[model samples]
Target: ETLMEWQEQRQKPHVAIFPGFGSGHHIPLLQLAKQLTVYHGFSVIFFTAKWMGASPHQTPPSSSGGMIRFIELPDVQIEGDHAGMSFLVRIPLLLEKANILVEDALTSFP
Candidate 1:
């Protein structure tokens, strides 16, 4: 089935959190997802690139009769002389992709 059609079949109150690349962003995003699921009882989805090296130690508990989910995307490796690229040049790209992933995930929810 097509992606949009599959998304349309999902349950309600779904939220996708994207932490993007690097440990700094990933950690907090995971923590936030945990809090939302455990305390707030929200169905939270996490999106991260496979190359980011982030993984959950334990599965999030299911709520509202459905399970929490993690979606991983293929990592983008910019092959260039990073010896010259500045943080200003790379940070925005990371944020942009992260946002895109979150949007994609959200679009799947009802």
Candidate 2:
């Protein structure tokens, strides 16, 4: 390819986005991801839960010409008494369990 194209590709800033559990959380972040790639010329890595809890909007739009990528963190199992707990109270535990996978994904990201 051309030098300009190579330089532009190399210069694009990379952004890693991990939205919260439900659709309410995912939609806004997904919008931001789209804007970053489409308008700001950024490369984005969007992370989502493999098994979305109660959100109907599971499938987000596809990547923007390879500038944005979607990666699913493997299903996180919530054990113990969390079933009776509210979302706010249980989210920390959920995220803690998912942290390792997130780190791995970021480390191996190209």
Candidate 3:
């Protein structure tokens, strides 16, 4: 491939997606990301918080057609008793910390 082709690939619009905290949030967003990369010729970065555990239906990066990238942010532990907490109540706390990590990751992304 020529340098121009490589440069053009790099120039594809980059999309960053944060699907909050679970499968309900992640599944639809993953579909959107796949469509954006496959049909729209854009590159997508899908971010997940590590504390949420494995996604219910995520493909490994190697099989993503080189268009979608998955970033699993370092987990941030929320203090106090989370055993009784509802997911909705805990999301805000997780996101508050995840946002900073996201920012850092984006800054270093190509």
Candidate 4:
């Protein structure tokens, strides 16, 4: 069968949503994913950093539907030593690494 037919036969569409680093971006995306799975009947997968996976504020996945999945990636940290540097100096590097991790996650998705 064709790809579309195969997908239809399975009766589910897989969707991956990746939010930017930090809680500001992650919370909304996660809420949206839950809504999509619980109310809209779509399979939702969330790609987030390891920190999010360990967050205590987020809701647990729905147990009955089995439509949502969480994929946690390692926290992206700066490689070099910036000993005694100010927050401003390290912030950019952290953001850059997070962006790189996001790109890598997207490219590696199947």
Candidate 5:
């Protein structure tokens, strides 16, 4: 970025937060997200994989507060595996897709 663009961006920093697919990860991650928005002046987007939840019936929660947003992908399926195992196998694919999403989102900035 040019110096002018960089200076303007600091006025509205953007952070993309994608924690691991378990609560042991998401809990602390959420806290960090809160701090980044509340203290650091960053706008953050939190991504959760489609299958991640305490129970299958539970829906992914949403945050409407300014500077924070949440998005969830559709669940992945791998043939001939138990549900738990499939989650681990699907992580890499999801990460790749998320990276693409991030790059696309960045292009809209500036």
Candidate 6:
């Protein structure tokens, strides 16, 4: 392995990061993404709820100096007819949807 190989590897370390449902959850994740991209030369894809403002702050590698990106989540709704376990039970379902979104984003990465 040569220095060029190592540098190329550095340029290609991709990561996808998502935070849970609040600003408290968001800041820490964003800080870590910042460190990973700024200090370690990582390509980061950061996920935020659509309500959390993903598109405005997306910093994809092609778009800026910082290789951190933000992908927005779609609004999730539970079917009213199937509301047995209450909204709490629907949380995981929403996360499942988010996981699918993440998987799709990953597959689309080049």
Q: What's the true lDDT of residue 13 in model 6?
A: 82
Off by over 4 Å in 5: 1-11, 54-65, 79-110
After best superposition, candidate 6 residue 10: deviation in angstroms?
8.8
Residue-level lDDT tens digits of model 6 in 1-110: 47986567557788888788666777677778878877777878888776443333543344334577677767766556645776577678778877887788778865
lDDT tens readout by residue for model 5, 1-110: 57985676567877877676677777777778878877777777776665555321143234424556666555554455455566556777666766676566556544
lDDT of candidate 4?
Answer: 0.66
Q: Candidate 2 on 6-88: residue-level lDDT in tens?
A: 67776899898888777787888888888888888898888877555433236555656667677878878888877689978
Per-residue error at 62 for model 6, in Å?
15
Expressed as tens digits, the lDDT of each residue in 1-94 for candidate 1 is 5787456435435676766557787778777776776676667777767556665534443442343577776555455675688967866766
Worst 10 residues of 4 by lDDT: 51-60
Give lDDT: candidate 5, residue 99.
69
1-110, model 4: which lDDT tens digit per residue? 57985576358666777675577777777777778877777777676665443341366565526666666667766676777778679767866777676677767754
Worst ten in a row by lDDT for model 6: 55-64
Model 6: which residue pairs collide? none
50 in model 6: Cα distance from truth in Å?
3.1
Query: Could you tell me how far off, in angstroms, the CA of residue 9 lies in candidate 5 after the best superposition?
Result: 8.8
Model 4: how far residue 3 lies from native, Å: 13
Model 3 per-residue lDDT tens digits across residues 1-110: 57986688789988898886557778788888878887788888888765766562356445346777788888788899999999889889888888888999999986
Candidate closer to the true structure by lDDT (higher is better), 5 or 6: 6
Report per-prediction Cα RMSD to one decimal: 5.2, 3.9, 3.2, 4.8, 6.5, 5.6
Order the numbered candidates by TM-score, best leading.
Answer: 3, 2, 6, 1, 5, 4
Candidate 3 backbone collisions, by pair: none
Greater-lDDT candidate between 1 and 3: 3
Report lDDT per candidate.
0.63, 0.76, 0.79, 0.66, 0.63, 0.70
What would the TM-score be for candidate 1 when compared with the true structure? 0.58
